[model samples]
Target: MDEQVITGTTAAEIAASVRALHERGALRRGDALPPVRELAAQLQVNRNTAVAAYRLLAQAGVVVARGRAGTVIAGVEAVAQEGYAADSVLRDVGTGNPDPGRIPDLSSALARATGRPVLYGEPVIDPALEARALAWVRDDLPDPELRITVTNGAVDAVERLLAQALLRDDAVALEDPCFLASIHTVRHGGYRAVPVPVDAEGMTVDGLRAALDAGVRAIICTPRAQNPTGATLSPARAAALRALLADHPYVLVIEDDHFSMLSQRPYETLIGPGHRRFALVRSVSKFLGPDMCLAIAATDPETADRLAFRLSPGTTWVSHILQRLVLAQLTDGTVLREVADAGRHYASQNAAFAARLTERGLPAEAGDGLNLWVALPVEARIVAERLMRRGWLARTGDEFLLGAHPAPSHHLRLTVHDLTAEEAARLVDDLVEAAGRSAPRS
Candidate 1:
């Protein structure tokens, strides 16, 4: 019998065909795809069309290219609220979220939102909210002339910022083990995600330089409490990155300070003086509550103007009510204290867990943010399986990988800040036992 044939005359049709095949289970994860030239001939289309189709697939995270080794189906974990499992008997330490009990109450804030009715032709942003947001962001921005725009959230701001700056297939430098939402945004937009290796001190200078050399048109980085890994940029590392970015002034640099209010570390930025195009996004989700879904995007004038085109009134402006609510909470003395307390709570809990792991002979350092990135003595996936059996759901580091296929990792990003002292201790004991079981026999 003849082998299964894949065919399409255009890029869209080709992408649709591959997606259909994957959906039908005809193409499994890690399965090899036909070479672009071979597939073009089979489909009777131009080579560029095949290339375009593959590019689309790559951006969608449906497939990955292995250079001369050819393209293959991507084995990506579904992007969702991490560490959540339905109908499970496990304690979940994988959901990257602030404790609900700690989120600032908005009842009074919502009540204060009552005012004169906003109508068409009015400014998109709530004037009062804009004033507060501007003041809040201006404190961190190096550029005095940076303009501010509010969006639904960090993800929304990033999507708009990138959309305004880059064309499809433009390379975007993203930290390896990036945030899930950012990964989804980049893939759905059909951009090449160039991986920038992140270490203890946040984004490495060499990684940034390599990404720039690869012709990446944009970069997205987290200055503190980076997702999954919980890495923060050190002052020295931030200086090095800023120096490198100074030479490539045109590259669109986006800094997502997702943990802005809750971070234990000070904000260290990479956007240098005279850097032409850049944006710094600070979302209030971590403290104000995820449901609040508000972020401030501070960018250079040109990028702000470009972003404004998409956010023009009636198209997709963030709700004025939400803006007022965020502002109210941000400015309220009680809420401010609550946010600060929450930050300290997370830092203490993470440190406690890391110390517990250390006492168990597992060297662990709890990084900033809500999670502890633990290096295991065995394959993380294997240990995760063992954990599942012991009734604990943890996130393996592999789920956050970008670019090429990576070597197997022994890292686990556990959301243990919300865990109680007893609960955390129990989880660490389980993890230690799981690792022991999964370790290779001598």
Candidate 2:
């Protein structure tokens, strides 16, 4: 260890070393650093010098001290980079957000919804929004007889729904590498996440059956554009899921149709007629403006009643003002027009990028959602690491997988919905390079 000497002669040298560590972004808030003794030994510095450096760093507001948590990174998210490229690409291929330009425009009509000042404690449910949102999810949910509830967002709705339905340690089945929010929700609530396998055809019914057999109390399945995968559940596959859930009457099936309005593919009904307990959660966040954090959930009357109770107790309900805003846009002819435009923009961007990939000999294709899933011949982790070097971040299929044995398929979930033509082309080229680099180095 003495052979690897890191001498710090002057105060500037110690300051430079500390600054270098801070610049790397690894040493962030709430993250503990090596003990002064350990670091001094590593850097071959005097213990007093190490203490001085720590003190200097602390004074800079770069980190804070907690008894056990130690020094952590502060003011990180606010720090801006040179171009949006490394940070969020001022042009494209970053932020992983749906194209705001293409979101259903509410500009002309939203003003009318704000006509009246919204009164708190009044029935927060916007009947107009409910009527409109119901139509949006009509194809995938129960008959007109079923009840619907409005929520702040699909995320908020899912959290409330899971809370209402499951107790701690209760088993819930989710697609392997499911949506990040769902995964976090399950963990936050201390619920055991049961993994269900998803292939090109979406979630496998057989895997779901196995999870249920293992005594999962609830199942949350994404029918189409299965988040990172962009694999739509085929009608046949949906039917299989229905039969599996039908056999387990007590298991609550929560189908997340977050991509509803934006997805071009025909919707698949995983919660079949015979399936009694189910909730179809749909959010406008992806297709519509995120500022309008609204979701329309259609479920059986009993489940709706329970969810209402969860949303109730106090006046914690969906805002009528926000709902009215959404309803105004929805009822007007504007949304359908925006939906068409958004769909075209998304399909075109994804298709162009996929075509670029295919040209570079990486087989890729456009899927229904705001993203596309590309499968490489090699492992995705290897490919993703190489991509990280080129300032590209991607959600891997592993994040969505729900199985035990490591059937590692090399796939990347890429969001091209906001990518410009040139950016898309460059991304495809970079991806092909990364894919090549990931090849086994035997």
Candidate 3:
């Protein structure tokens, strides 16, 4: 990577030149570019122009800024994703998915969802769905002036909310050991993620205050059924968070209550009555099935208006048919009962597995949502490797982590609710054996 490879006067022109060079294979991954001052001097451009050019490159994923190490060409890093790996031979406990058998069948509801075809320029939300969705969230959210907007899913809602409220490189607070999609969304959107540590009680107050003091413009919180950790916000914790956030009334708060219907715990909210900007997103994927791909956002009027801008009349609105389908299933008494049964099934299975682990001399607890977050005595990667050898694919805790911690995470997030009795027993035996293998000999 020679300094001569970079050329052009303005920021866009300089960015284009670097892109062209990369396209031609002159600038390879990890190859460092000239320092801002040096590049400005060589190109005879303003220092700000050089900085802007690098910024563009970074935003485009063509380069990464390594602080004082300087800017370098970025590798095509594969982002972590949810669900099972394709063509995996092992029994995959890594998939963070709801048990498919328990998902309420939508075939019966499809007919009820259909009627007169919706046209462009009509209301974006299905009238009935809107009513039901509002009723669904009305009791939980503090804002009486809440408005509902539909999107592709919880991830889409989060992406749009952040896009509407903040600019690129603006800091956003995310829970440490965050959801996979949220992590991907913030990074892909080029926002700086300020990690707030999460514990059994949910996001730590001190951690969030630190993020706020660091000038984070927005906060994305999972009020209940937090992924990976499966930690829910207690009433007291939520109240404390709300009290802390009361002073920062203007900062945008987006609560992702993804496991709304299936969660066994009570819903706790961080949005206080007077908070100016907030959105509570609830996706139907957990109980309705992932392919349903719909979520409702109940938000403040101003945030709703900003979110509506991205969900244009014809092009971006969620399909009316899908919304109707969701409404039909939600309103069905039998389906609701089945959903409740599924919730109990998951809770029981996770509880049974935790008990087995405890009986095996490894203490564990079943938390809310679809997965169990088990703390291991040894390094998670070491245990994971041993599990792999025993024909199990496990999701290690470190994968969900953001920022640096005092020590490496020695935990595993296992989705064992879907496993059979025999399979569950085998997994426990394997896990105990794996942990033993990770121990040092005298």
Candidate 4:
């Protein structure tokens, strides 16, 4: 590709030209581009204009900066996502999904959710939903001066919050063994992910301090029922984090309480009362169902105002119908009871599974979320491979790790809440057999 393939004066124009070249197959993936100064001089534009153009491309994932090696067209990498893989014949114990049998039926809520046509210029959140959401999150959040915003889901809210608060390439603190969607979101946005190590008691104090020292602009945390590991923040841990964050009040803190209604553990927050920027997001997915696609974010007024731009009226606003549906289910007595039962059910089932695994000589713990984080004596990949041979598809813990040299994860996240007794027993036996096969021999 010729250097002249990239041509334009302004930032947008330069970005457009590069995009056009890529579209025409003239600038293929991994192809090096001229240095910023060289490109600026050739195009007769300011060096800053060239820099801005590259920034835009990087943010859009069209190109990536390679330090002294200069910029190159980005090769898209396939990211792993949640839910079951299509057309798989194996019994999928790895899918981090809530039991459909436990999810409250939405048929009755649908009737109540409809009625009242919402026109343009109306409020984005349904009035009833907003009121209920405020009450729902009021006691849990530290800050009293909160404004509510509804987004498609917890992931959408995090993406918007980061976009509003930080620039591309800015550092954001995420749990080391992070959620799949979060890792994908941060990578797709071209942001730097600073890994904050999570333990049995949730995000560690030292890890968080290191992230803050690394100049992270934002921190995404799971207050309870953390994904993969299922580590909930203890009160002591939350207090220690609050103390550490006291000096850096302006750093945006986003607590994703995705398992709010169904969490067996009480909510613990890292956001202190005086914290300048924070958002507490609660999605109804766990108890209500994933297809609902509604999450309520109770955020500081300023953060909420900034988030409004991304969720502009009539453009990206979450549907009022969905909001009403969630609100209807949230307030219904029978539905609330069912959600509570679901929480207890998940806890008991996970505990039972953990006990079975422990009895078989593989130590396992019943974590707060929908899954059990079971540690294996051998490498998780080896055990997973062995399990595959035995007609089971399992998720290895390495898939959730961050950074270039992450510690080898020897664990597997298993969702066994919905499994029948016979299936559960067979799975335990198979897992133990797989681990035994994978263990190193003398």
Residue 60 displacement (Å), model 3? 4.9
- Give per-residue CA lDDT, model 1, range 190-276, as digits (tens): 677899999999998888999999999999999999998889999999999999998899999999999998898999998888899
Candidate 4 ranges with C-alpha deviation above 4 Å: 1-20, 34-56, 67-70, 437-442
Please report the candidate that would top TM-score against the real structure: 3
User: lDDT by residue for model 4 over 1-442, one digit each (tens)?
Assistant: 7898787889999999999999899999899999999999999999999999999998777898878889999876667889997899999998999999999998999899887788888888788888898999888874668899999999999999999998777899999899999999988887889999899999999999999999999999998889889999999999999999999999999999999988889889999988999999988888899998889899999999998889988799998888888888988999999999999999999999898888777778898999988898888999999999999999999989896554577899888998999899889888988888332211
Give the Å shift of residue 158 in candidate 3: 1.3
What would the TM-score be for candidate 3 when compared with the true structure? 0.94
Q: In every candidate, how many clashes are there? A: 0, 14, 0, 0
TM value for model 4: 0.91
- lDDT score at residue 322, model 4, on the 0-100 scale: 82
User: Candidate 1, after superposition: displacement of residue 342 in Å?
Assistant: 0.6
What lDDT does the true structure give each of the candidates?
A: 0.86, 0.72, 0.91, 0.90
lDDT digits (tens) for residues 1-442 of candidate 3:
6788789999999999999999899989899999999999999999999999999988787888878998888775567899998999999998999999999987899889988988879989898899999999999985679999999999999999999998766899999999999999998887888999999999999999999999999999998889989899999999999999999999999999999989899999889998999999999999999999999999999999998899989779999888989999999999999999999988899999999888887789998989999999999999999999999999989889999778878999999998988899889989988887332211
Number of colliding residue pairs in model 4: 0
Instruction: Tell me each candidate's TM-score.
Output: 0.86, 0.75, 0.94, 0.91
What is the lDDT for 357 in model 4? 80
Off by over 4 Å in 1: 1-83, 437-442
| Cα-based lDDT at residue 286, candidate 2 | 78
lDDT against true structure, model 1: 0.86
